[model samples]
Target chain A: SQQGEEDPQALSIQEGENATMNCSYKTSINNLQWYRQNSGRGLVHLILIRSNEREKHSGRLRVTLDTSKKSSSLLITASRAADTASYFCATGINFNKFYFGSGTKLNVKP
Target chain B: EPEVTQTPSHQVTQMGQEVILRCVPISNHLYFYWYRQILGQKVEFLVSFYNNEISEKSEIFDDQFSVERPDGSNFTLKIRSTKLEDSAMYFCASSSDLEPQHFGDGTRLSIL
Candidate 1:
């Protein structure tokens, strides 16, 4: 299906802790992106990792891609209560169309 | 930063009625797309438009669904006779040449 599937459908953690989420896909992709959606809000793009790039970082967010395994992971360091949201990974094969995952609902307790 | 904008945040319509969702993509973007997310489900791609024509579409974008760039800045998605199952959050996105897509806030469609 080329859709990315996120592991650990739900995760609960305390503030100031690090939270990690994983995504796996079935086919080759050109890029993978991560997005966060707050309750009843629009999706906010977090990061993007190309197939050739192994890792990328943006402030508190770290993303890694492994083409051999067709998997990717996102790590949020020092998470705050505001970080609580649904995280989704989308795989783009043609740079135009993307297939999204079911998402991992994250709950960061204060 | 430029952002995609959508109008009519929420719409309520009767089953079998027609609905049109409007979006103003980033001015410089060359690609526009439509997506929908059913309550508690993953986001699904509906169609992609470039050069005033559909570049690609998913199985969900049947004959009843259509897209048009009626003007230079406006992109619209029209659903003819929306079914109850068509209720969902419709999102509009735009991007420029391989860049990350910028998404609008989305329109919530309710078919009763």
Candidate 2:
């Protein structure tokens, strides 16, 4: 499947610490995007790293893409209690369709 | 910021019934898509529509499933005959060109 696999299905950290999640996919992609879903809510786009781009950042979120390895990582710096949510990595391929990973459930304790 | 919107936050229907989930995508966005998450499972793509036609669809979007852009701003997904397995959270999304898709909170469909 084109769906990616995210390591450490769940992560717990303190509010001031940094949290990192990794994702690996099996095929080439046009772009890799990170999204956060607050329980029972829709996905909120975080950042997108193109196949040719190695890294990208938006606010407190930093994303890195290693197309040669078909892997990506998302780092949330100085996490806050409100940052608790499930984060997913989606690989955008042909026809603009996206295949999503199972996601990492993040918990930030205040 | 513009956003995608879906109607009937939650719907309850019997098996073998037809269900139509409606969505109003972000205005001026040229691409529309439908996706579903079966409880704890990963989000799965259903179909993508552009230029008033289906650009691509997954295996799950079979003959029993159909999509339409009946009007300028509305995009809809119709299931001919719903099944228990059809119970899920269906999401609508829209994007312009190669931009990231903006998603709606989603419609929770329950098939009894």
Candidate 3:
């Protein structure tokens, strides 16, 4: 089952602009993670935020989580054409069970 | 960087036939999982395995589907009777903890 749903099914932005994608989940979670998938390729782990943590930063990517609202957001600063890919939010439940979202397709135009 | 690997990147099989998808999770990871994505659809969880046994499974993992870790490093998912709807990209993932599961490229199964 899909527990998380990402907003803005598709996003198009110019290079150097900040791109933001939001995700909302239905249940309590242990942690939330963001992944990047390029076309038909496999997913690459980007960052993870625990439920207790409100925000985290890894390089040019920033993730924020709000447990009360059951929502999270991923912001990619200074987007590049190479950053054009689909982004998915995955919620980790008990015992390593993960439910993934429908994903937001981001297209960065250089 | 250590990564999960899946074999037979793409496979074509006929309906009612049996097919097995293989995976090799990160060597040190303790938890393994299987997920699938239908064309243009969201990824769905199938099963999670730990310590040589299934830890959890979804409703989609019925009698027709089974998962096993036949050896120390290999994990496999078998479909006893393939259906047209089973055509999808099956992904294998592993995590050392409850968070940050790393994923493989996935195997595309096309049922004819």
TM-score of chain A of each: 0.98, 0.97, 0.96
The digit string of per-residue lDDT tens for model 2 on B1-112 reads 8889999899999999999999999999999999999999998999999998899899999999999999998999999889999999999999999899899999999999
Against the reference, the lDDT scores of all candidates come to 0.95, 0.93, 0.92
Clashing pairs in 1: none
Residue pairs with colliding backbones in model 3 are: none
Candidate 1 chain A: minimum summed lDDT over ten consecutive residues — where?
A39-48
Per-residue accuracy of model 1 over A16-103 as CA lDDT, tens digit each: 9999999999999999999999877778899989988999999999999999999999999999999999999999988779999999
Error of 2 at A1 (Å): 1.6
Worst 10 residues of 3 chain A by lDDT: A91-100
Superior by TM-score: candidate 1 or candidate 3: 1
Tens-digit per-residue lDDT, B69-105, candidate 1: 9999999999999999999999999999988888999
What is the alpha-carbon lDDT of model 2 when measured against the actual structure? 0.93
TM-score of each: 0.98, 0.99, 0.97
Clashing pairs in 2: none
lDDT of 3 at A82: 98
Clashes of 3: 0
- Say which docking band candidate 1 falls in: medium
